[model samples]
Target: MVQELMLTLQALGLPRPVRGTLASQLVREFHGKVSELLPSLPPESMQPLLSSPLDASQWEALESLSQSLTEQYCCRRCLLLKRLDLTTSAFHWGDRAEGQGEAMKAVLFPIRGLLTPESDVSVAHVLAARADLSRLVPATSVAARQGTSCAINKVLMGDVPDRGGRPDALEAAMPAWQSRREDGGRGKAGPQRWGRRKKKKK
Candidate 1:
């Protein structure tokens, strides 16, 4: 089938290109079978990424792609990510978000090839939802603390005292206690007496 196709192309423009056409045909077939990678990560490993403060995945993908593209035939790895069939690279963890970003600008088109229209839309939607959620939720402990904890108009507890003071002796002591004229100046427990003193005639 390929020979006939190559022969036809030769008649028009590829008279000397047998190998290049055959290679192209093989690549097309290969991509069809390989376009199933989806960049799978272990639940344990993915947990940290999910818990991370940053919601952006593009940065992670770009970082990974940056290192991968410096190697030979980088498209293989990228295609694997795009297809979502991460079974190929089981332990191949990376900052894929960053790598993918860098790959988009690479001449090899490695990034674009893996990211299809549907996947792009899905990613954008997820990032948008994340951003929306981020606004609704507090980003830090301090931010969460700043929110009101109660809906009541007034505090149930009385106003907190700014400074501490000792209770007055009159308030703390009983009415039965009597303070002598001299005892008043000296804050000592006055002698307790039930009746007044009687005057003795000389």
Candidate 2:
């Protein structure tokens, strides 16, 4: 298949490098479009379609499918962009209530059913919907912080004055740790003292 593409490109009088590059790009696009269409195709048709070389008619079909998909995506993108413009554009103070209504209709109302506590929708379904929505409208850094447990500013909890005179657990344990070390040192010295006493006895 690649050899055939290279030959076709070579017939166009393209240089070797250009032919190679163009062939690679064309093959990638063909594979990508085929992958997109494969899921929708019947299970029985998949093996034969993949195994055989695509004819002119088959190529035309793939090309048409790709074109239609591209058009649908562009239409969706335009709709989203227009909706975003409506959302962010300034409006009169008197129009705020109207704007909020519009926002609810445009955004919240679509997903209101999913948001209901009694809804039978699975968490995976809700998550998939959220994922699709997230792709359509990219999240901002501020939006990313929503539902996060961490605070924006760090507070020094230990630095606060201890009015109750209660020592921390670690601070209270320090004396015990020090006493153990002192005890170990005295035990070592007792062995030396016993050795000196034995020499005196001798």
Candidate 3:
């Protein structure tokens, strides 16, 4: 079923951005045939998923299957690392900023298939859940490494352990694993460079 879903989605060619389930990235491509698939997707069809037990193995399987499909049909590779290295897995998520004045600091993330249809959770709540994911991300990695930067301008995992202060210090010690980029890449950036160019006074 997973493979079929992957194949069908690939055939439709949706522009899925890089997403992480258990520290793995998805194949984000700029395909033009996404509309056709949307209609085909039956909303209720996903309900059966809730009944099935979702243990660690099940999650692992889902991750593996997605990774395989990403490599096969999407012309992409998949890899996993600790959640801490979110700077890498972060991709284009369409995180649009909301409101004006005092409410400007907070941003809104795109949530289409993420929330369960059974619930009536507010968008803020949904974004909060994602923020929770971000908080844990820092803790899941040990070795300092970069995976994928991101496209939605910035990478916010949505993990806010405390809607208060910067997440705990644990996230920094975690380790991360990810796929190598073409230029042997990294997701995040290094120290800011601020230097003036030489003037050409001819």
Superposed model 1: Cα runs more than 4 Å off: 1-84, 87-93, 96-202
- Which structure among the candidates has the greatest TM-score? 2
Compose the digit string of candidate 3's lDDT tens values, residues 83-118.
322532243233542224224222322232232223
lDDT of 1 by residue, 20-118 (tens): 457677556445533432244323332322334543586677556644544433455566655654542332345664566444346435644655422
For model 2, which pairs clash?
none
Writing each residue's lDDT as its tens digit, candidate 2 over 1-202 gives 5665567546544434553356567666656756776787655443221344668997778667666766676677667656755664444235556657576456644664343222233323332342223344334457665655376346555676666755553454454333444554645544333344435554
lDDT of the candidates, in the order given: 0.49, 0.53, 0.43
Worst 10-residue lDDT window, candidate 2 = 115-124
Candidate that would win on lDDT: 2
Q: After superposition, how far is residue 4 of candidate 1 from its true place, in Å?
A: 6.1
Q: What order do you get sorting by TM-score, best first?
A: 2, 3, 1
Candidate 3 TM-score, C-alpha based: 0.16
